[model samples]
Target: MKRYGSIIGVKPEKLEEYKKLHVAVWPEVLAKIKECNIRNYSIYYKDGMLYSYYEYIGDNYEKDMQKMAADPTTQEWWKLTDPCQQPVENRAPGEWWAAMEEVFHMD
Candidate 1:
């Protein structure tokens, strides 16, 4: 499995709303995540940033991501959650969250 990490800035004013939304994530979105071979998914909040970590078990990461993105349920989910986030200044083109390099891992 390949691990991924990313960061995005959360608006301070919307922090509670973001947290509340996550407390009961939509079933369809959760299913799509697993359907796309994403596991151990977690999102953490610190300061003004949201950090996401997940493991990709599928052979084709890009294709799985595309599938997730193309899902109507995920699209509707993003409509609610996207507004509470701000893309980091240095994120790659088309990235809503700035991907991070994993310099070291021991496990």
Candidate 2:
């Protein structure tokens, strides 16, 4: 499995709503994430930024991501959640959340 981490800023006004929405994520959207081979997914909020991590268990990362993107439930979830995020200015082109490098890991 491959682990991925990403970071994005959150609008101060929307932080509470964002947290509330996450309190009970839609079941269909959660299922879609698992269907696409994502596991151990987590999102953390700190200092006005949101950090996310997940393990990709699929052999084809790109293909799995494409599948997730195509899921109606996932698309709908993004529509609700995306607006709460403020992507970093320097995020690479085509990236909504700036991907992070894992410099160290153990266990």
Candidate 3:
């Protein structure tokens, strides 16, 4: 398993709306994530910033991600979620959510 972390900003005005939508994510979207081999997925919000963590269990991360991207339900889900976000200014190239380096880990 590979652990990943990333960060993005939530537009202040859209914070409440974003939080509301997450209360009941569509079942199809959830299934797509599992089908792509992402597990232990979670998103956290704090001070206008959103952080995400997930473990990738697939042999090919990029391939699995592409598979997820090709799903129509996932695309529609992003259409709803993307508007509420602002990518971090210092994010690395090609990063929508800034990839975070793990400096420490316990078990």
Candidate 4:
């Protein structure tokens, strides 16, 4: 499996709503993520920073991500979650969640 991590910012005022939404994620969106070979997914928050981690078990990573992005359910899910997120100042252009570099791992 390939591991991935990303970072985004959540406004302090909207943190509660964001946590609530994640507590009961939409089933269809979850299915779509699983269909794309995503597993062991988790999200963490500290202060106002949100970090997401997941493992991709499939061979074709690009295709799987494209499939997830093309799903209507995911688009709808993003509509709700996106508003709760604030891109960090250092994030690259057009990036909502900045991709994080993996520095170390033990297996």
The TM-scores of all predictions, comma-separated, are 0.97, 0.97, 0.97, 0.93
TM-score of 2: 0.97
Could you give me the TM-score of model 3 versus the true structure? Answer: 0.97
Give one digit per residue, the lDDT tens place, for model 1 in 1-107. Answer: 99999999999998999999999999999999999999999999999999999999999999999999999999999999999998999999999999999999989
Model 3 backbone overlap count:
0
lDDT, residue 68, model 4: 93
lDDT of each: 0.96, 0.94, 0.96, 0.93
lDDT for each residue of candidate 2 in 46-71, tens digit (9 for 90 to 100): 99999999999989989988998998
Candidate 4 lDDT (Cα, 0 to 1):
0.93
Regions of model 3 farther than 4 Å from truth? none
In model 4, where do residues sit more than 4 Å from their true spots? none
Q: Which pairs of residues collide in model 3?
A: none
Residue-level lDDT for 35 in candidate 3: 96
